[model samples]
Target: MVGSIKSGKSTLTNALFGGDYLKRGAGVVTSIITRIQPGHGLRARLEFKTWDEINADINQALILFSSTPPEDGGGDFDINDEKDRLRLQHDLSRLNTDQLVSDDTLDPNCVLLTEYLSGYDRVKGLVSSEPVTHMFESDDFHKQKDFVGDESLAVYLRDVCLTLEAPRGFGENLEVADCQGSDSTNPLHLVTIQDYLIQTHLIIYVVSSRTGVRRADIRFLNLIKKMGLTKNILFVINCDFSEHETLADLKGLVGRVEKEVGMIFPAPCVFTFSALYNLFKSIDYKGGVEQAIARKDRRRLEQWREENDMVAFSDQQTEKFLKAVIQKVSMDRFALLLVSNLERISSISSGLRDWIRINQDLLKKDAGEVQEAFSKMGKRQEASDQITMVIKDTLDGTTLKLRRNLGNDVERFFDSKSGEIVQDLTRFIRSYNLSIKDYEKDLDASGFLPTLYRIFQTMQQTANLFIAESINPKLVNFVRQEEKKAGDVFEQVAGPYSLMIKDAVKQYQRTMKKLGIKIQDRPFKAVRSPDVDSVKSDARLNIPRLAGTIQYSTRIKTEAILRLSIYKTVKTVKKLLKKPVKEGPDSAMRSLEASVRGIKKQMQESIKDHFLDYKESLKYQYVFKLVDAMSIELYEALTDRMRAFTGNLSDMKGRIENEGLAKDRLAEELASMQTSLNVALKETRALEKLVMIDE
Candidate 1:
C-alpha cells in the first residue's frame, strides 16, 4: 500500500516482486483498483468493476439510492447532482459512525439507507454549485481531478476480496495494489487508504521527481500523519532518466522531494529509479529488432540500408541503464531485509528482563543496609549525654576560677571601677556581637559550609568572653587597668578576652579530637637536621687568641677616710579651725555605711555587665554541644553505611559485568546464526539460478 498520486507506488511494487502489475502512464493512469496477487504460473490478474457496480456501491454507502425524484420529474436525476448529494452525505456521516446501521438486505428502506438519506439532501445542496460529477467521470480524473471517490471504493473492494483467498506460494501470497494517484482531495480516498496502510504490514510510498512534492503530496502526508502511518511508508522516487539525463541530477531532485515528503512520512526505506527505463528493459529487444532487420535486409540494397538503420536505432544501450535501475529497485528489497533483521533483534527480551531482576535485588540490599545503619546510629544517644556533661564541667571550672580569684572583694572593686569597666565591656560585647552578626550575614550571602564554621567559631569566642567577664570582677578590673594603661578599654578587654577564647577553643578542639573527630590545626615543622656540608676540615691555634699580652699603667693614691656633712631645716605652723573635728564612733559607723552602700551599687553593676557579656557565649556553648553530639553520631553512621554501600556496589558491578558478558555472547550467537541462515539462502538462490540457466 502507498499514498498520493505520482508517489511511485506502482514502480516500487513492480521492482520488488518483478513484473509490471500496475498501469504506468502519464499522470493517474490507474483509474480503478489493480490488485497483483500470486497466480499458478508467472502471470498477473487485473480485476475491474463495472461503472454500474461502482456507482451502486457509492450510492449505497452514501444512502443516496433511497432518494427518488417525483414521477413527473422522471427517474433521471442529474449524475452531477446525485454525486454531490452523495459526497455531502458521506461527509456528514463520516463525522459520526454511530448513525450507521447494519443491514443484510441492500434495499432503500434498510437501516443503513435511512442514515445516509438523512444527510444526503444537506450535503447535495452544499456542493451543488461545483462540477464534481463531470470531474469524477472524466478520463483525466486519475491525472488531474485531484480526488477519486470511486477509485477509493475500488481499492477497498480489492483488499476485502483478496483476503478471502487461501495462502499460496511465496511469490503468489504477496499482493501489490495500484491505487489512484489523484485521490488526494477525496476524503473517502484518504479514509480507505489510511485504513489500508494501518492494516498492511508493508507499504511503499511512490513519488515522481519530475513533479517533485506537490500540493497533493502535502495532502497525502497530512492524511498519513492523521493516520499515524509513518512506520509503514517506504519512499520510492520514480526518476525517469528520459526526462532527466544525469543520475546525480535525478538523485538531487529526488532528494529534495524525499526531504519535503519525508517530514511527514519519514519512511525507513528510500529508493530512486527511472520507471520508464524499467518498462523498456523488460522487453525482448534483441530478438524483436533482429527479426525485423533480417526480413528488411532480404529486399533491395537501399532497403537493407534502411533495415540496418532500423536495427541501429533499436540498439538503445539499455543493459547499463537496466543495471542502475535494478540497483535502485533493490533498495526496497533491502528495506525488507532490514525490517527482518530488526524483527529478529526484537525477539531477544531476556537481557532487559535479567537487568530488571538484578536491579530489584540491588535495591533490596541497599534498603537493608540503610536500615542497619539507622539502627546503629540510634544507639549513639549516650554520646550526646557525655558531651553535655563535658560542656557543663568546663563551664563549672571557669565559674570556680571566678569565685576563687574575686569572691567577696569583687563588690568593693566594682564600686570603684564599675562605671568605667561596664562601659568598656559593653562596647567590647557590642563589637563582638556586630562581628558575629556580620559573619552570620556573610554565611547567609555565601551559603558555604566553611563560612558557616567560621561564623560558629567567632560566635563561640564572643560567647566565652561574655561568660568569663560576667563572673570575675578581678579579671574585669585587671582588664580595666590594662585598658587605662593602653588608653583604649575595649582593646584591653578584647585582648584578655581573646586569650580566654583561644584557651576555650583549644579545649573544645581537644574534646572533639578525643571523640575521634580531629579538627584542622596550624602546621608545625619538625627540628631541622644538621647540615653536614657546613662542617670544616681544618682548625687554627694562636697564642694571641688566648689573650697572651696587654700593656698597662697604674697610679696609686692613698687617701684617708673623709667625713660627710648633713644639714636639716624644720618649720612649724599652728592653725585654728572654725568647726571642730569630732572623733566619735557614730561618725566612723556612718562613713562605713556609705562605703557599704557604694560597694553594693558597684557589685550590682558588675553582675549586670558580666551577665550581658556571657549571654551569647553561653547560648553558643549550649548549641555547640547539641550539634557536636548529633554530628558525631551522623558521621559514624554515614561512614559505616558508605563502607557497606561501596562493598555492595563492588559486588553488583562484578555481577553486572559477568551478566553483560553472557548477554553479549548470546547476542553474538544469534547474529551468527542469522548470518549463516542468510548465507544458506543465498547459496540456494544461486543454485536455482544455475539450474534455470542449464534448462
Candidate 2:
C-alpha cells in the first residue's frame, strides 16, 4: 500500500491480515516491501540487497538525513541539538572520508559481516530505555562477519522475508504487501516503489485525514497511475494518529482526496479506517497479542502499549470509531471488493474455457468433410482452406466476445462502486460532534519543594521513552505475519483453478459421450507454492545508539546553576535562622522553587533533542527492504494462474487439431458448441450478467 510516513500502511497490512505483524513507529517501518503469502510452515526467507543496492539506499538515506534544508523545516534548532553534527561525523568516520580526501583506497575488507544477534540479546537483556548499537558491515562488499539467529533475531532484522501461519482466515492467493511512505526522504526507495507497482494488483493508498493530499502524495499517486496500477490502487484515509473524527469529518477528508487524485483517477471516496482504533475493535489488536503470547514475542507489544497509553487511547477511539468505520469507510466493503476481484477472474477464465471448447467441437465435426474432400487431389487444398477459414473466423469472434464481456464487466464494476461512494461521501464525512468551552475558573495548585537541589534532580530525570521501544515488536510481529500471509496466498490461488477447471471438464466430457466414444479426462497440474527458508546475510551493521547517548548538552552549565542555587538557598535559610529578615521563610522558599521551575522547560527540550537525533534514522531504514523484496514475490504469485491458463489454452487447441476422433455426431442438438447454451456456459454468463446487472 502507498502512504506517507505514519499514515498506517504497516498497521493496515496488519489489520487486513488480522494481526500486527509489521512494525509501526513514529518513523518509517516499510523500507522494504513486505509480500505476504501462504507458506507450508512458519519460516522467513529474507534476502539482503546486494552491497551496491544497500549502498545506494544508505547513500540516499544519509543525504536526506544529513542536510537541514528548508524542506526539512530548517531553523536554528536548540543549542542542545548536536545530532546533526554528530550524525554527520559518524557518517564521515564510517566512510573513511580522510582517506577519500587523501586519494587513497579504503580497506576492501570494510564490507565484512558482523554478528548482531548476541549484541541485540545483550541490549535486550539490559531492558533499559537506553539506545544501543548493532553494527552493520555496510561499507564494503568483500568483508564478511557471519551472524545467524543464535538466541535472538531483533538486530538481524532490517529488510526481511517471513513466512508464518496463525490468522484464521489466511488464503493461498491473498497477498498483502506493506510499503513505505510515498514521500519517503529516500529517492532510491521511491524508484524501488515504481518497480513494485508494475506487478501490484491491489494497493491500499493510505493518507492522513489531517494532512489531506499534499504535492508528494499527488506525485507518488500519479506515478502509480502511469505504471497502470490505477484500478488496483485503493485510497484509505487513516485518522488513527489524529483526534477522533466523526463521519462528517471523514466525508470532508474524502472530498479533499478525491479532488487531488481526481486529476488522474476520480476516486469518489477513499476507505477511512483507523489502524490504531482497529487495534481495539479488530483482531489486529486481539489476535496479534494472542499470537505474540504463543510465540513468546508478547513482552514488547504488551509493554509498549501500556507505556504509550495505547489501551486507554484505543478504548477512547473504539467508542467513536465503530460508528465511523461502519457508517463511512467500512472494511467490510473493501473485503467485498476483494471477493469481487476473485470472482471476476474466475468468470473471465470460465468464458475463455467455453470459447476454447466451442472451437474444438466445431473442428471435430468438420473432420469428415475434410476426409471426403481429400479423396479428390485437386479439392484437398480448397477443402482444408475452407475448414481453416471457418475455424479462424470462429476464433476471432470468440476473442472479441470475451474481450467485450470482460471490458464491460470490469468497467461497470468500477462505475457502480464509484457512484455508490460518491453518493455516500458527504454522508460518510458528515458534520456531527459536540463543542466545549474552556473551564471558567483557574485553581492555583501548590506542591511541596524539598530543596533547590532535589527539585532540579527531579526535573532532570530522563524522559525514559526508549529509542528502541515499539520497534522490535513491530519487526517481530510483521515478519511472522508475512510468513502467515504467504501461506494464505499460495494455497488460495493454487487450489481453486484446478478444482474449477476439472469440474467443468468433467461436465463437458460426460455430455459428449453421445458421440459413441467417451471423452477422456485430462490431468491438470497445479502450480506448487514456492519453498521459503531463512537466509542470513554475512553482512551486519552495528545498530546506532540514540537513547543511551542522551545527556544534557549543557550539563556543566546546568550543574553549575544548580550548585549556585543551592548555595543561595542555604545562605537564605541561614539568614532566616540567624536574624529575622523583612522576607519570611515562605518568601525565600518561593524564590528557590521558581528557579527550579524555570529549568524544567530547558531540561525537557534537551531530552527531546537527544532522542530525536539517532532515532530519526529509523524514519526510513529497514522499511523498504521488505517492500522491495515482496513486491517481486507477489508479482510472481499474482501472474501464475494467468500464465498457466494461457498454456492450458494452447495445449487444448493443439490437442483438438491433432487428434482423430470417432463419436456419434449427437444431433445438431448440441447446437454448434460455439452457440451452445451448455450448463456451464449458461452459469458463467449468468454470473457475468449478475455483476453487470448490479451496476
Candidate 3:
C-alpha cells in the first residue's frame, strides 16, 4: 500500500494493523523509510541523523572550539572570523577517539579544552586521510558526519532495508511489512513500491475514507497499470470512527470514489474499518476500565492544560492501532492461499503429460507406415540393373523375332504404343498440374501461401527424381510390372497422398479459424448507371446543323449592330471635319485626312480590348474544369488507399493474436512431451532394475 504525505495513509496503515508503528508530525517527521515487523520484543535501532540535529551539533562544536584557550597556557585563540571557526570545528568533529575526564564539575577552563579537543578528534577521524581544511568543503564529509548521531533516522532506514532484504518472517513461513507513509511520494518510495509490485504475489492498497484517493494515489495507480500488474490487489479503506451515525454517508462517499477510480481498483475485494475504535477497545482490555473518558472534540487546547496526559493518550492510540493492523494482514495472507489457482496449474500440467504419452504411440505407428511405403519403391542400383537387362534382351532376341514375324509393321506398332504411352503421360502431367494449381488456390484462400510455397520447394527434389530415371531400362520394367500388379502406382499412391493433403488443408483451416481470420476475395465493382437515352438521342441528332443555325443568327445581329454604329460615327466625324477646315483649301484637306486617321485608330483600339477580355474568360473556364476533374480523382484514390490500409491493419491484428496463442500452445505441448518422455524413460529404467534383481 502506498500514498502521498498527510493523506491519512499512515492512519489507514495503523488501522489495518490495529496499532501505530509510524511517527506522525506536522511537516515531514518520517524523513526516511521505516519498516515494522511482528516479533516478541519491542526494540528500535538508529542508523542516521536529521538535518536539524546536524546543524545544532556543528554549531555547538564550533562554540566550544572558539571559546577555549590555546594548549601552551597562553591567551585565547583569535577566532573572530565565523567562516574560519566553522571550518576548524568541522575538521575537529570528524575525528574518532575517546577522552577520559574527571567529572562534569571540572574547572571551566579544563571543560572547555576537553570538549574542544574531543570534537576535533571526532572530526579528524571522519576526514582522517585528507588535509584538515579539506573536510570543510567536501560534500561527502559533511553528509557522513552530519547524520552520525541521530538515532531515529538511522533506525528507520536500517529497518526498511532489513525488511526488504530478509522480510518479516525469514525464519518462519509468513511476513507482513508495515511501511511508513511520510515519504510516500519520494522517488525511493516509488522504487520500493515498484519492486514489490513486480516481485510480491499480493498487495493490499490501504486508503483513508476521510482523505479519499489523492493525486499521488492516482499516479501510483497509473504506475501499476504501466507495469501491467493486473491481479492480487486488495483495497483496505480505513475509516477511524467509533460511532455509526455517519456510516451511510461514508459508504456513499466510498461508492463515489470507487466509481471514479474503478479502472485502477480492479481487485476482487475492498474492506473498510475504524482503527480508533479498535484502539479504544484495546485500552479497555489492557487498563481494565469500565468507564470511558468522554471529552468534547476541539481543534486545539490551552498549552498549560495537560501535556503528559496528551502524550499517554497518543501512545495508547498508537499501540492499539498497530495490533489490529497486524491481525488483519495475517488473515489476508492466509486467505490468498485459499483463493488463488496457482496449485491447479501443476495438476493440469500432469494431465497434459498423460495425453501426450498416449498420442506418441500413434505417431510412431504413422512413421513406420511412411518408412515401409518408401522401401517398396526399390533402391537406385537394383532398378538400374533390371532396366539394362530388359533393354539388351529386347534388342537382341525380341527385335529379331518381331522383324521376322511382321517386318516393318513391328516398327509401326512400337511407335504407336510409344505414342499412346506419351499421351497417357501428358494427361497425367496435366492432371497433376491442375491439382497443384488447385492446391495453390487453397493455400491463398487460407492465407498460408508462403508456407505452401516452402512445402512445394521441399517436394520439388523428390518429383525431379521421377523425370531423371523415367527412360532407364530397369525403371521402365519396374514401372510396367507395378502398373500390371497395381493397375498404376500413381492411382495407388495418390489415395493416401490425397488423404494427407486433405488433413493438412483441414489443419490450416482450423488454425486460421482459431485465430479468428476470415479470408475471401472481395472484388470492387462500379455502381454508376449510364444515361442510355441521352446518349442515343445525342448520337441521332446532328449537332453541327443546330450550331450552324445559332451561329448564323448571332452573326447577322452582330453585323447589323456593327454596321449601324460605325456608319453613324463615320457620318458624325465627316460633318465635324467639314466644319473644322476654315483657314484655307490646303488646311481643309489636312483637317479631313487627320480626322479620318483618328477615327480609324479609335476603331482598332476598341476591337483589340474586346478580343483580350474574351481570351481571358475562356482561359479561366478551362482551368476551373481541369482542377475539378483532378480533385475528384485524388479524393477517390485517397479513399481507396485508406480502406486498404485499414483492412491490412485489421488482418495484422488477427495475425498477432494467432501468433501469441500459437506460442502458448507450443510451450504447453513441449512441456507435456518432455514430461511424457521422462516418464517413459523412468519406466524403462525401472524394468531394467527389476530384471537385474531377478537375475
Candidate 4:
C-alpha cells in the first residue's frame, strides 16, 4: 500500500487483512517497508541496518546538524566522540526554531540526527550479521507495535518481513507491503518506495478523503507512470466518516478524487470506504488495555453508522475491490505459471507416446532389424552433438555483444557532466533560489553565523529532495529499459535454436519411420521466451544518499558581524552566495554550487559502480545464465524426443534374443502407458480450455 503520510495506509492495511496487524496513524516518519505474506501463524523477521549503514546515517545526520563544528577545527563531526556528541546536541539547540522544529513537524534532517543520538545505543545490540526473528503469536503480537510505531527504533530497521495466518479470500502467493508515505519529509522514504514499486505486482494507492488529490499524490502518481506501472495500480479514497455527514457527500468526494486521479491514470480503478470503520468492525479487541480503546471506537462506529448509513455502500465497494484484486493476482499466476506448466506436460506426454510407439514397433522386429536401427541411432546422436555445438557458439557470440551494449548504456546514462539524470539535477540545483533577503530578520535576531548555517542546511535539504524526487525515478526507468533490452536479445538468440532442435527431432522421426517403426507426426511446440522476471538481477538500484558534503567554517568573529549594518551585510551575503563566479570568498551560493557539483560527481561514481555490478549480474547472473539454461532445456527436449528410439533399441534386441517373450510383454506395457498418457492428455486439454475461457 502506498500513499501520502497519514492517508489511512496502515488502517487500510489492517482492514484488508481482517485485523489490526499494524499500528494505525503512526505519527513518526516510517523508514522501513513492511512486507507481509501468507503463512501458518503470526511471526516477523526484522532486518536491521548494518553497522556501516548505521554509521553512514549518523554521518549524514551530522552533516544536517547546522551548528556542528568541524572536528580538530577542520574536519567533520565525529559521531563516536563524546565531546562531539555533547557539542552536537548543543549545536542542535542553537538552530533557528523554524529550521529545527515547526509545530509537530520536525525537519527531516534533524529528525535523523536526533533519532541516531537517541536510539543508537538502544538498537545497537540488535544489529548483528543476520536478521532477528520474532514470534508474534499468542500474547507476543502486541510487542510488534513497540518497534514499528516508535520512530527511533523503526529508523534502525532496514525492512520488515511479517507472516500472518492467511487472511480469508487472500491468495496464497499474494504478498502485501506497507510502504512509507510518499510525501514523507525524509526524501529517502520516496526512494525506498520506488524500489518497492519496481518489485510490486500491484499498487494500492490510498488517498485520504480529508485531503483529496494532493500535490504529493500527483507527483507520486507521475513517478509511478514514469516507471511504467500505471496499469496495475488500484486507487482507494479512504473516507473520513467524521468529515462527511451523508452517503451522498462521501460519494461526491469520491467522484472528485477519481476525476483528479483519472487525469494521471485513465479510467483508474477507484474504491471508496472508511478504512478506520472497516478496521473497527473487523478487529477482535482482546480485553485489558484494549477494552477502553475498543469501547471508544465502537461508540464512534455506532454514531457514524446511525448518521451516515453508508456501511452497506462501503462494504459493496470493498467487496468489488477485493474481487478485482483476486482476479488480477490469480490471472497473473495462471497465465505466467500454470499455462507454462501445462504446456510442458503436453510436450512430455507427446514425447512419451512417441517413445512407446517406437519401442512397441521394435518389439515386433527381429534382432537383425534392431541392429540396423541402432546404427542409424548412433548417426542421429552425432547430429545432436553438432546441434549442441552450434547452440553454444551462438550463445557465446550474442551474449558478449549484449553485455557490451548494456555496459555502454549504463555508462551513457550516468556520465558525470552530460548524463541525463545528472544534468537534470544540476539544472535544478543552479536554478534553486535561497532568497537570502527573507532571512534578514533571522540574521538580525540570530547572528550571521547561525543564519549562514541555516542557509547551508536548507540547501542540503533542497538538493536531497531534488535527487530523491527527480533523479531516482529516472534511474529506476533506466534499469527497467535495460532489463527489457537484455530480455529481447535473449529471446532473439533462443528463437533459431528452438527451431533447429525441433527440426532435428522431426528428421530423426522421419528416419525411424523409414525403418518401418511408425512414429507420431505431431509438430513440436515453439519454446516459450525466457521470462525477464525469472532472470531479473538481484541488485537493487540504490541511489547514492545525500550527505553533508559542503563544509565551511561557521566560526566568524562575533564583533565583525555586529560591526556591519544589516542592509549592507545582507547585500554582501546575497552577492557572495548567489553570484555565478568561478572564484569568490566562501559565499553560500558558491558553497551550494560546489556542494551540488560534488553531489552530482558522487552520484555519477555511485551509479557507475552500481551499473558495473549490475552489468556483471546481467551477463553472468541473468543473460548468460538464461542462455545456458535455455540451451540445456532445448537440448534435453531434443534428446527426450529421440532417446527412446535409440536407447531402447538394445533392450528390444535383448528381449527378442530371450526366446520370443517380447511381443506379449511389449503389448501389455504399451497398453498400460497409453491408458495413463491418454488420461493426462485429456486433463491437460480440459485445463487449456478453462485457461482460454478465463483469459
Please provide TM-scores, in order, for all candidate models, with all chains considered together.
0.29, 0.37, 0.29, 0.82
Lowest lDDT 10-mer window, candidate 4? Answer: 551-560
Q: Write down the lDDT of every candidate, Cα atoms only.
A: 0.36, 0.41, 0.35, 0.67
Q: Write the per-residue lDDT of candidate 2 for residues 446-499, one digit (tens) a residue.
A: 112213322333233212211122222232233334434544444454455345
- Per-residue lDDT tens digits for candidate 4, residues 1-695, read 99998999988987777677787777556567788888876777676776666666666555424454333344545555677667767777667676676335677767777776777677767776455544466557667777788888888777777787675666677788988889887666777777678777789999999999999999889888877787688999898878987889888988899889989899999998888887777663433444234667778977867754688888888889888877777766556556655666677777777777877776677778877877786687688778767766766677667667776776677665667876676566656765655666765676555564455566655666776667666776776676677667766766777677777787787788789988767766666555555433223222233222332222222222333344346667777898543344234333333434444444444444544454455445544454445444444544443443333444554665676575787679788999998998888888878677221
- Per-residue lDDT for 312-424 in model 3, tens only? 43345444544444444444443343221122222233333433432332223344442332233123223333433443343334324422433232222223234332333
lDDT of 1 at 638: 26
Total clashes, candidate 2? 65
* Residue 446 local lDDT, model 3: 32
Which residue runs of candidate 4 sit more than 4 Å off their true CA positions? 64-84, 101-105, 128-137, 284-293, 304-309, 431-440, 537-683, 693-695
- Best candidate per TM-score, number? 4
Clashes of each: 12, 65, 36, 1
Off by over 4 Å in 3: 12-21, 25-31, 45-156, 160-172, 180-185, 240-245, 288-695
Off by over 4 Å in 2: 26-30, 39-42, 50-159, 162-171, 225-229, 245-251, 284-289, 292-382, 385-695
Considering summed lDDT, which 10 consecutive residues are worst modelled in model 3?
543-552
> Residue 266 error for model 1, in Å?
5.1
- Please give the lDDT score at residue 128 for candidate 4: 61
